[model samples]
Target chain A: MPFVSIRLAGTATKDQKSAIVADVTQSLVTRLGKNPAAVQIVIEEVSPENYGAGGQLLADRDAPKPQEDAHAESSQ
Target chain B: MPFVSIRLAGTATKDQKSAIVADVTQSLVTRLGKNPAAVQIVIEEVSPENYGAGGQLLADRDAPKPQEDAHAESSQ
Candidate 1:
């Protein structure tokens, strides 16, 4: 059995998910000559809070800087 | 640190998830001598509609058979 796991930093629409499953299945079929029937794929949408990259959580990395927020407030 | 990702075809209960995390953590610790605290496990559940097998979506494969439905309707 060929199992594929995809972890996304954020969510995807149902259409996107469907397309991904189809594409991955096709790729495996083309490359390995594997049966599409035996290919299994799981798409995981991970929240930034739970995903870490570059030694820090994605949420912290992507969050607006405090100074930037203060600047915006001051400008307003 | 060892990271493990598990994909399930359907949903799991909280107790099942907790047990799985604990079991996997222990396995890494026993086999690889990795620290339990450093072991990170992510469990992903995929709906049948988003999963494909036998060259078709699982949802489609498991759907009610047209012949069965027709027989039921005729009997009714």
Candidate 2:
């Protein structure tokens, strides 16, 4: 059984979820000759606060800065 | 570095999530001798409607049914 788990940075519409499941199933069927019905896919939407990169939480990294000048100074 | 993704059929409390992350990280460290700090675990709580098995959506399978007799009749 091919169990595919997909993690998205944010939420997705029901349509998007449906399309992903279908697309993934099709890929497995086409490439691996797997049974579409047997393919299980799970889509996970992660909150920015819970996911981190570059040693910074995404929520913090994407948050608005105080001022353009201050931000530029901090980056330097 | 190990990235672990866990998909649960339903939601979990924040405390439970924290424990799960810690437990998973510890497991990797103990078994594979990976650094606990380098272990990344994402816990996904999936809606029953979005998960399917045995050719039926979990939502439908877990939904409240009609009278007991009617349900028994349909299963046969």
**Chain A TM-score relative to the true structure, per candidate:** 0.84, 0.83
Best model number under DockQ: 1
- Name the 10 consecutive residues with the lowest summed lDDT in model 2 chain A: A13-22
Cα deviation of B34, candidate 2, in Å: 21
lDDT of 1 by residue, B22-60 (tens): 999998999989989999899878787667665555766
The total number of steric clashes, by the backbone 3 Å criterion, in model 2 comes to 0
How close is each model in CA RMSD to the real structure?
5.8, 8.3
TM-scores of the candidates in the order shown: 0.60, 0.53
Candidate 2 regions exceeding 4 Å error are A67-76, B1-45, B49-76
Q: With candidate 2 superimposed using the best TM-score fit, by how many Å does residue B68's alpha carbon deviate from the native?
A: 27
iRMSD of all candidate structures = 2.0, 3.6
Query: For residue A39, what is the lDDT in candidate 2?
Result: 75
Each model's backbone clash number: 2, 0
RMSD of 2: 8.3
